[model samples]
Target chain A: MNKILTIMWKDVRVLFQDWAAVALIIAGPLVLALGLGLVTGAFSNSDAPTIGRIPVVLVDEDGGQLAAALVDVLTSDDLSDLLAVETLSDADAARARVAAGDASAAVLIPTGFSDSFTPDMATGEMPASVTVTVVGDPGAPVGAAVVRSIVEEFAARADTAVAGVRVGLTQLAGSGAVSPVELPAVGQSMAAAVFADSAAASAASVIRVETRNVTATGESFNILAYFAPAMALLFLMYAVTLGARTLLSERREGTLARMLAAPVSSAQVLGGKVGGIFLGGFIQLAALILLTTLLWQLNWGNPLSVLLLVVAAALAATGWGLLIASLAANAGQITSLGMALTLLFGILSGSFVPLNDAWPVLDWLSRITPNRWAMDGFVALAAGEGGAAVLVPVAALLVMAAVLFAAAALFFRRRQGALLTA
Target chain B: MTTPILIAKDLRKTFGDLEAVKGISFSVLRGEIFSLLGPNGAGKTTTINMLSCLLPPTAGTAEIAGHAIPGDTLGVRRAIGVVPQEIALYDALSARQNLEFWGRLYDMRGQALTQRIDEVLEQVGLADRAKDKVKTFSGGMKRRINIAAGLLHKPQLLFMDEPTVGIDPQSRRRILDMVKELRDGGMTVLYTTHYMEEAEELSDRVGIIDQGRLIALGTQAELTRVVGEQETLRLYLAEEAGAAAAQATVAAGDGAALPADGGLTLFNGLPGVLRASAIDHQIVVNVADAGEALPAVVGRANALGLHVRSVDIEEPNLEAVFLQLTGRGLRD
Candidate 1:
């Protein structure tokens, strides 16, 4: 145990003494994570323009009073504010404009404008129903809905004005204040027509829209809260790879063989190396997490849960480093192989991107990589859930670490004699 | 006596089909500098490695410091210190640090470790530069540190394998002196080198190996005795000396009659000359007494109208003995 401690101390001292190693281990991950987070945030913020204006084109075919009233309502400020209204000469032209993406929808009023408003005509089967053709862009559903609301408001206001005159006549008859012959003529007049037009326009101005973004579960998307865990796990992988370089350096310098020649057993030597790298990896992760929190205002959920995740992540990283070093012959080979594998696992594990929307094959592949489990654990912790939910992934990570560490130990034991000779 | 510090009885080692050491055997008494002298591929290093238990032999056995090879490899490893030909010190570490590291490996620690490190540093004459990294040190300094690291454990038997392969003359001398000094202090050493002078100067018993076989093993004088009692007297004749002039020099005075080989004039029942040969404008006179015949041969050459450029009298030595035994030079 003393020998193991001595070896461990020497390794730690060497790593700390090296400026390049320290910088890469600590500062490298912080820089990469913060840079990627800020850049992605900037792009998402800039590209997602909020819904403000809906474009619509109008086609007024009737030359009569009713047509003029409907057109007035459609062109009023209340409707125009929600929909950018463009006047087109014909229904065909309006449809063309909508198809060209210049408009969200088109409202076309037919020729029978004043006829539909007469009391007898309204009571009987309405002639041609004062048809208003509505054309809309297929893709712009919100713009189409805004246009529909405006048209509905105009129709309801016209119907209410017609009903008010009937109510007044009925009340006068019931009171017996005057005979039916003494009543004013019910034929359409210019003043009444103009007054009706003004009423429709005024009613359109009074219409109000209250849109509520309601989800099935009543939760809105929070970008920062969603991606913070993934970014942390990615940086953790970077830390692990950087820390693993120590193993390759020792092997290249023959210092490892020199250490083995001491009275320390092979297990002690392996343990010391693993412990040193594990500590280095954890330090890097802690620095990255601190920097991310300070710079991006990242909330890492519960402190205890985050700490547990960090520890398990460090162990898994140490195991991965050992496994890579054991298989490589030299430092360059180790770095190349480690970089490739880390990238592969990181992508499959959704460290850089979300795996939920990823291809099905990739989702399955994530299950086999420790990085995926690590990321899952981070997500659970970041979501303010008791990391108890992350126990399976944490256990899986621990098992992976044990398997890799054991393989590395076995490799070292088998090659112990040959290494001495070398 | 006292179970000989190291013993190898007909040890053999083969790498695949090639036999590197073929049944070579020797023993080293305690507190002696035993050397194995051979050319580069002559199985010296292979034999030393087997003795040090760094490599296992294919056949036979070696007991190092009273422990058998393979059977007691760990004991043998603990009992012997190996200074390999290559510089194996850590380049990134200081001399003292390297010593401390090796000391800890050998189970020395704390004050005792520091004390040993200081002592070895001073012994290697690197105490002033002990804190400097080894890569910054000179070749000689690195070699000294290499030797110092090996000596940290204070083993009973030390193996120095080609310790002076490439170095300045002063450094080589210093190393040789250090080896001798260590042996004088009751340390048994098995030193191997191809340089015959190194062997002649330091070894108590020298073994000559060639092509994975031990061809000669004995003291310097014993090996020299193999060349017999004949002495050679050579006279460098002038460029213009002809065959008649050479014949006249050989035939003068107490020199005997000529032999059937015309170039060689054999003198029997003479006072000094036993055989004479002339080739390439130079004459070699084999005499019974080089001390007596050299002057006489020079005088005869001067009298025969042959101007002697130079004259040399030589006695048989290890080179001649090696040549006689193996029909090739020691280096070959």
Candidate 2:
């Protein structure tokens, strides 16, 4: 372990000592983020362009009170500037409209979605839960994203309302204030009151834009929030590439053989190299996040979750670095491959712009990139979601890291003799 | 009679169909500078690599510092330090930092590692520049630090593979002197070089390797004794004169076939001149005695209508021994 740290430390020291590399990895992302922010008019005094009303198709299969309340919220005059709702009977046709770009999203309230919140009169128990599916158009990502966010907010409020109804019924039955036969009616009345309160709160805070302009979406949605992580992750790929290049550079320079010639095992040397790449990428991302936060006053969300995303993202990016190193024959080849992979991943992962999910093939390819998964987590956190929101993205990034690492290790094993020898 | 610190029997290595080390065998006694003298592509680096545990031998067994090669790799690595032909130090790191990293890998730490790093730096005469980045150092200085990194742990055996490969004469001199000092301090050294003069000056025992084979091995006197009482006569020819003559003879279609050795075959039948070969603008002849073979050898060259610019007579040395054994110069 000590030997591995020594090797890792040495590599990191060497990496930082090269000023040109340091500048590219650290300052490059920060400057690009700043430039992107400027170009997007995030810093301009003019009102940020408002998105036109999103065209949505509603398929209400439940026909229950909670489902009606959801429809009312979407079609309300207060949110008229945000959503344009069209009612459809067939769920399949609604989704087809979204897929065909005729609608930004299709909100499908499955049967029993509202009943799942209602307690049975005899058992005082609710039915099994059902979900509301939002099929989003790949062509209009922002509009779809907005519709999705609104639906998510409605579901969260309904959950709170159901919890309130459950607690009120328990209190009423225990106190003997109402007969068991009246429990169902009382539960319904309490649910309506709670839902109305939650619906009002959701309207004022959940999906409303506070100001007329200056920034798109809500007041919390800073353009830097999107571009900052985007640019940082783009260059995080470059940082790991730099670290990976050392694997081949050291061999060509004889330092690798010298290390192998020491009393350390081949595993230890490679472990150190892997650790160095991970640490370099982690530091690059952490540094960029902190710099952007400090300089631009951009909020990146809960610190702990951001740290988790950074670690997982770095691990995934390092796996890519190792993969490139394993495939390349020399340091020069690694450099070229690394740069190409960096830019390619950036473009494919929607680092420059939010990717249009309209293309299924492109969406699937984006899933393979660390940038896409990490950007999902960062954007969620920046939008005021809790740490729980990042669990899926973090897990996906980890699995990507594991698979890529295994592949790189297999390649390294096959070329073991060539790597460690003269 | 010192005990053997390293012993190898039939160590062989093959990459695809090209056999890099072809069943070579030797040993180095403790407290001696054993030199492997061979030109490039003679498998000197391959042999060292196998012994250093960087490469596993394909067929054969070897023991170093009481550890076997194929099995006990860590033990062998712990007991040996390798200085590769290239300057392997990290250019971005300071000399002190680079040494610290290598030292830690050998399990040295804290004050002990610090003191040892200082000692090695001072020994290599780079203590004053220890804090400066290696990129700021001269090529020779970097070479010295490269050697210092290997010496931090002071292993039982140190393998210096052409340590003075590309440096100024003065730097090479300092390194040679330092190597001799290490031997005097009771460290076993396995040095490899292509320069005959370096082997003659440094090795307590020399192993002459060519084309992946150890053709000769012994003390300088013992190896030279292979060509008993022989001397070398170097006849300098004027501006490819001999080659021109050979080409002219071939062009004439004289039906007198020219030998492939560039007219050196003309002196083969001369009395007292046992063998002859050509290297560039000179012809080297091996004979029993320079005093007896000089006049006859020069006369033969002149008789062949080749202009002899000058002549030199050298006593028996590694060069003449290599010529007698392989029919070629060391630099060939």
Candidate 3:
């Protein structure tokens, strides 16, 4: 244990001695968070940095039942506090409003949008698909994403309703309950009722949460609370990578062999390396949180939970670092793979953008990265949620750390002879 | 007789089909500087690694300070100190800090570790630079600290593997002197080097290895006796003369001699000349007596139209012993 600590201390010392690495891994995130916060007007004391009512223009060319349902859902009382809806006649003009940044997004309902949902009896098949397009502003990604989510939900429910009606009509035709000539009319009637029912249910549930949230928090959300942890978690990976790099560098320089030659076991040596990486990451996160609090006056909520989240996040990030080191052939390879993983994880975890609900696939994939879980916990905490809100994210981060550490250990064990040999 | 501090029996290591160490064995007596002398890739470092427990031998057994290799690895490691061929000290750390870390790994702590660090630093002649980062030190200074780290725990045995490599002559001399001091202070060192001169100067007993085999092992006098009553006559020829001699010798086609070795085997059967070989610009001829063989050797070179710039007759040394045993110079 003493030997492990000794090696750990040595590795940490080496990591900090490289001034360039220290600046890159520690100070770089602080600067970026501050800059992003300023740009996003997160520091404005008069107004909270909440994603308030999103401005959206609707161009309903369909003039059909389904299009009217979508317009109703968007302009519903439940979403009134979340989305500021407007009606436009021209599709091109609605898109222009989005492009001009006058609105967060524009929902363009095509001319034959509703006709696609009804089947023709002669063909016994659905009409050619006409898609509804949501043109979003590049500047307000969160607001634009919210508007897009609503449209996507409406489309998904309509598709399900049509499919349900098709199944019902097919069964009715097989049972000789309806004639083939009347099948199309029956399918259209069933589809409209199913679509309206599902749309109302989905809208009531999904749109209700937004209204309740805005009301409960009084539209208060700290943007820095999001960017601060996002930036910190992004660079925490870099810090652990830098630490993991020393495992190979020390071997190349003969220091690893020197350590192994002492009374220390290979387990002790590796344990120290793992501990060192975790410690480096932990210090980087804790220091960033403290610095951002002092410099940016950002509150990270529930000190105990924040500390635990930092530890779990650092542990998971260090596990990734170890996995990269174990797979890489040398210090140079570790650096290349580490940098690539850092950036890839940063983008995937929505460190630069809130993407937790952007796409279902993206949200699921983001679960594999520590940045996502840490960011979620931090964002929740910043929104004035209690410590209980971080429980799931913390648990997920711990599980990620365990699995990655086990995999890295197996790899290290296989290469133990090659690595520890002179 | 002195007790053997380290004993090995048929230690061998094979990397796939390549046999790096081919079942060779020897022992080092307590309180002696036992040098393993060989050329590069000659299994000297491999032997050191195996004994130090860094690598397990494939087909042999060895014990260091009563700790067996492969079984009691922790025990062996605890009893031994390894100064690797590379300057292994952390360049980002100060000399004292690096020593402190290595010392603690050996379970040294508190005042004892601190005082031991100071002692080792002073012994390496870098006490004044203890606080300076290792990167700020010269190549020689780093090498000294590298050795100092190994000496921190004051183990029963120290393995210094080619410690003087790539350093200036003055620094190499200082390290040599430091090794002598350690030996005089009752330290047992297992030193490995490719330099014959270093072995000749440092080893109380020398083991000459080649092609993963221990060709010869004895005291300097004992090993030199392998080339009984032989003297090396070194003939330094001018560049043109050397090249001309090499071409002529190859044209003669005595025994597939390479021109890179100067191919100087013209005086094979000269009176009192036992054998002849070439190294660089000098042709070395092993003879029974320099006085009897010099005239004929020089005359033979002249007959071959080779100009002899100067000549020197050297006493039998480790190089001559290696040449006699393996038919090649230690640097080959």
Candidate 4:
């Protein structure tokens, strides 16, 4: 262990001693993340052009007032550019339209849906909720997901508006602002208007512009949050791979041969090299995580969970690094192979962009990369899902570490007869 | 006299069909410098590598500091230090760091490692440059640090393989001096070099090797005795007039091929001339006296109508012994 630490310390010292390398490894990822976050974050601005319209089929089974108002809200002039709504009479036709790819989603409003959400409901009494069934298309999930979000937002706002109308109209009548005979009509009309227009537009107009942390959402600043950690993980592989490449470089420089000539065992030498790569990768990631937190205001996840994932992620990355080193004959080969693998795995695992879930092949390919598991872990942790929520990702990361380390060690030993030296 | 610090009997190494080190056997006496003298690719470095534990021999029985090879590799390594043919110090690290790292590998730490580093730095005359990065230093300075690294643990035996292969005169002198200093301080040294002068100047005993085999081994004086008391007479003729007409010029051992001046043939009949051979424009005459041999050598050259550029007398030495044993110069 002492020898391992000594080797680790020597490599670490060499890493930090070159200030250019230090700046590039630590600051390069931060600068890149910020640039990407800003570029991607720009599109999420509220004032920017909204996405294209989603084709939606609406089937109102209930000829009631509440169901009619909800259809009016979805087809209102304000959402005319965002949602291409088709009012269909047959529920089977609406379902077929979604299934046949004619529409992104079909919204079915069952009978008695409007009855439970009427303005005549007693004040201070809980209102009976309704379930809006939205059948979405498998081919066009993005459009379907957008339509589903707008509908859910409308339901939440409409529920709030309906409950407030009853108590407010009575108060207004008592205060003499409105005549008692016309108060009920005024409350119904206001509730109807609330359900007629764009609830999302109104919500957006309420909040002032401000930057916030990265979360897996479509908020104004969520892109920055999404990209910052993803970019950090992507570039972290380069830093750690460079650290691993040093094992080959040391051999080229003859330091490894010199070390072997000493009283130290080959196992100790390789252990030190492996330790250096693991720690270097860990330090690079931890620094990036901290930097994003302090400067970009991006929260990675639960601190302990991030720490645990970072350790496992570094180990797994180092395993790849050693594997690259083991296969490489020299530092130059390692550098080329390491950088190539870094970019290949980074892009493959959806570090730059999400893998298309519709494509099972790409998803399967992504599972083979450390980036996928690491990103999944970070995503879960960032969602504030600490504790047991992180179990699978953490376990996956450990498994990756174990399997890759074993493979790398086996190849490295075959090449150099060392514990982990490449 | 002194108990042998290192002994090998029938050490051999084969790489595929090629035998890198053929059945070779030699030993190093305590506190003595044993120089393995050979040209490049002569298996000198291979032999050093085998003994250094860098490579395992195909077949051998050897022990260093009472530890056997193969069976006690770590023990053998613990008892010996190696300054390889290449400067093996970390270039980016400071001299002190390089020393410290190597020292730690030897399991030396605390004040002992530090003191040893200081001592080695002082010994190699690089004390002032200890804090400087090795890459920033000159080649000579880097070589010193490399040597310093090997000496940090102060093993019982040191293997210096062609340590001064490429260096300026001053640096080479310092390293050779350092080797002698190490020997004088009671350390066994096995130095290998293609440079005959370095071997003759520094080694107590010389092992002449060629083509993966040690051809000859003895002290400089003992090896030189192979040529007896006869001195070598060199005739430097024009290249066109040399090895081409060397036979005509030497005129055989009895001077029968040379033109006769009156009744006596022009060369070999001289009292000092013992034997003669022709090699590349140089007619080599082994004689009892160089002064008496010079006139006869010039007379023979004139009789053969070959132009004699100059004459030189080479005393019996390791170079001559190597040439005498292998029929080739040591540099070949």
Clashes of each: 0, 3, 0, 3
Residues A175-257, candidate 1: write the lDDT tens digits: 88745654344323322543454545534443222222212232222234334555555555655665566666665554554
Q: What is the C-alpha lDDT of each candidate?
A: 0.67, 0.85, 0.84, 0.74
lDDT of 2 at B116: 98
- Model 4 chain A is weakest, by summed lDDT over 10 consecutive residues, at A207-216
TM agreement with the true structure for every prediction: 0.55, 0.83, 0.81, 0.72
Which candidate, 1 or 2, has the higher TM-score? 2
> Which runs of model 2 end up more than 4 angstroms from their true locations?
A46-147, A155-219, B235-266, B280-282, B295-310
Which residue pairs in model 4 clash with each other? Answer: A214-A225, B242-B281, B243-B281
Candidate 1 matches the true fold with a TM-score of: 0.55
Q: Runs in model 1 with CA error above 4 Å?
A: A1-27, A34-38, A41-356, A359-394, A405-422, B1-3, B41-49, B52-54, B165-174, B195-197, B223-332
Ranking by DockQ: 2, 3, 4, 1
- The residue-level lDDT of candidate 2 at B274 comes to 80
Interface DockQ per candidate: 0.07, 0.76, 0.66, 0.30
- Candidate 1 at B53: error in angstroms? 4.1
- Per-residue accuracy of model 2 over A1-422 as CA lDDT, tens digit each: 99999998888898889999999988898888878777755677655433456899999998876777788778876567678899999999998998788998999999988778877766767878899988887556556767777788788867876787788888989999989889887887775555445544544443333222212344535767887899999999999999999998889999999999998988999999999999999988998898888887778889999999999999999999999999999988888998998898888887775555445577789888999999999988877778998999999999999999999999998998888777
- Over A130-247, each residue of candidate 4 has an lDDT whose tens digit, in order, gives 6777887755544554566566656776566665767777688789998766765676676556544443443343211111221123432234455566777777788777888888
lDDT score, candidate 1: 0.67
Query: What lDDT tens digits, residue by residue, belong to model 3 across residues B1-332?
Result: 29999999999999999899998889999999999999899999889989988888999999888888779998998888889999988888899998988888888889999999989999999999999999999999999999999899898889999999999999999999999999998999999999988999999999999989998999999999999989998888875544566676766765465434333457877899977766567777888999999999999887776778999999988877877776666665
Please write out the lDDT profile of model 4 over residues B199-225, one tens digit for every residue: 999999989999889888888888888
| Model 2 complex DockQ against the native | 0.76
- Candidate 1 lDDT over B42-73, as tens digits, reads 99888877876656789999887778976876
